[model samples]
Target: MRKIYVVGIGAGDPDHLTLQAAKAIGRTNVFFLLDKGEAKASLVELRERLIKHYGHPHKRIVEGRDPDRDRTPADYTGTVADWRHRRSLVLEELITEHLGDAEIGSILVWGDPSLYDSTIAILEEILERGAVDFEFEVVPGISSVSALAAKHRVGLNRVGQPFQITTGRRLAEGWPEGVDDVVVMLDAQHAFTKHPEADIYWGAYVSTPDELLACGPVAEVADEIVATRTEARERHGWIMDTYLLRRNR
Candidate 1:
């Protein structure tokens, strides 16, 4: 039987890789890196840096690109399911080509694999099909949410106050009622524009030398963040950003 390790390398910083994650990569026979195309080539480069910084001489590297899917469908769940299926197929193929007979194959994931990452879910589907005999293990790393909080020097939640983790799309639809603190991710639409009254702290490329951070009353700096994010994305060709919003009580 073979074993598979999904190791989170953390957001964009190679130093963010956990000690355990680095060990797992060093012990693996093959390393699979996901390429999200040119728009996100920086992500691929970051993984390469992690490998170069910590990988062993014997570990072989394999790269795979995720296929683009039109996610504008009405049924969000259906679209996500379809996309996962395709991703699983590609991953399985990569395993066969590079590590079919190896004792272990490892994939380096961004951030903690359990939070908002689909790699484990896709691997589960591949396992269910009985196409591969492997045991899955996850090595956690620092999450962007944690980095966001640290960069802003603020608590994600106030004393006794609950917080929610949501995406930009949902925020654009409208703020969730009754929630005072919301951490937003995958926000391509500047969803902060929707809640102009909330206080916001935003960070792009957290923990990296190129990191950009801004904070103020949401009403005061929301437009600045939007304009900054737009310009930054255009300038860098990619951006991985996260933000926290707190409604004034």
Candidate 2:
């Protein structure tokens, strides 16, 4: 049986790579990359830089075209399921056709493998299909959620309090009942602005060189976050952001 390592390379900055992630890169014979197109070409370069910095020069890279998905669909979950099925097929083919001579292959994921990443899930699907025989190990890295709190110099919850991590779409429906502390990720719509009373600690492109940060009452800083987000997206052609919202302040 072959082995694959699913390594988390951290949020945005190259410096976010942990010693474990660096070691995993050093061990990988082939780096399985999901091509996210030119808009996110910078991410590809970042991954390469990590390999170059940590691994030997002989390591090979295998690129697979990622399946396209409806960014705004009526049935979000259904669309995503279909997309992932297609993605797993693509990934399986890559594993079978690309790594025949290699014994150790790896996927470098952004954030932790346990978070909003799907590489681990797709790998599991491949195993369940009985088309491939490989053992995989997950190496966790610092998530943007943790980086968000660090950059903001604020705690996620008050002493003995609880918090929830949710996406922007779920939050747009309404504030979740009985949850005063909320961390929102993958929010493209500036959903945090809807609640006027909440205190927000927001950051865009966290840990990256083009990082942006703002904190205040949602009403007071909403316009600033919106304007900044618009300008950043226009400039970079893409953006990945997350924020924390707290009420009863």
Candidate 3:
């Protein structure tokens, strides 16, 4: 039977690639590349570079157009379900055509597959449709949450307390109750401004040369964070950021 490996390539930095991920890259017969449009084209370049350095020279690199996601849709759940359905179709085609019998296929995810990623879920959906028959394995790698904590030089949680990871939408709904440590991801808006008292440790373009970091009370640094994020996005044409917000710390 053909084997499909959902491989995590780490958060931007090649040095962070785990031994297992490197081995997966080396063994993969086909590495699937999902184009996320021009904004993240640089990321694809980085992935190609990684493949050149780690993967076998004669292995195939297959390209697929990822379904467009509505970042600011009115009906979030519906929009996501529609997108997932389209993605599943695309994956089905990739598996049926590009992946052959007894060949090792892989999709190199940006971060660990189990975190905020949907690749694994999409793969499961494709398999559940009863069209693709293959064994899939997930290879975990370092997530941006851990990378953010390390670069910020702070722990995700306080002593005897638990930390929560949420999206900007949830943070906008108001910070989760009973949690002092909140890590926010996929926040296009500066949701941290809603809480002026919280101390924020934020990082953007993490682990790259364009990396940016800011820390201080939300009130004091909100403008700075916003401006920096805007400038970085404008300059680079893209940005991937995450932050840890600690209330009453």
Each model's TM-score?
Answer: 0.94, 0.97, 0.97
Model 3 lDDT at residue 98: 89
lDDT of 1 by residue, 94-122 (tens): 98777765478888888899999999899
User: How well is each residue in 122-205 modelled by candidate 2, as lDDT tens digits?
Assistant: 999999999888999999988999999999999998888889999999999999887799999989878888899999999988
Which pairs of residues collide in model 2?
Answer: none
Residue 102, model 1, lDDT: 46
Error of 3 at 55 (Å): 1.0
User: Ranking by TM-score, best first?
Assistant: 3, 2, 1
Q: Show the colliding residue pairs in model 1.
A: none
Give the range of the ten consecutive residues with the poorest summed lDDT in model 3.
203-212
Off by over 4 Å in 3: none
- Candidates' lDDT values, in order? 0.86, 0.90, 0.90
Worst 10 residues of 1 by lDDT: 95-104
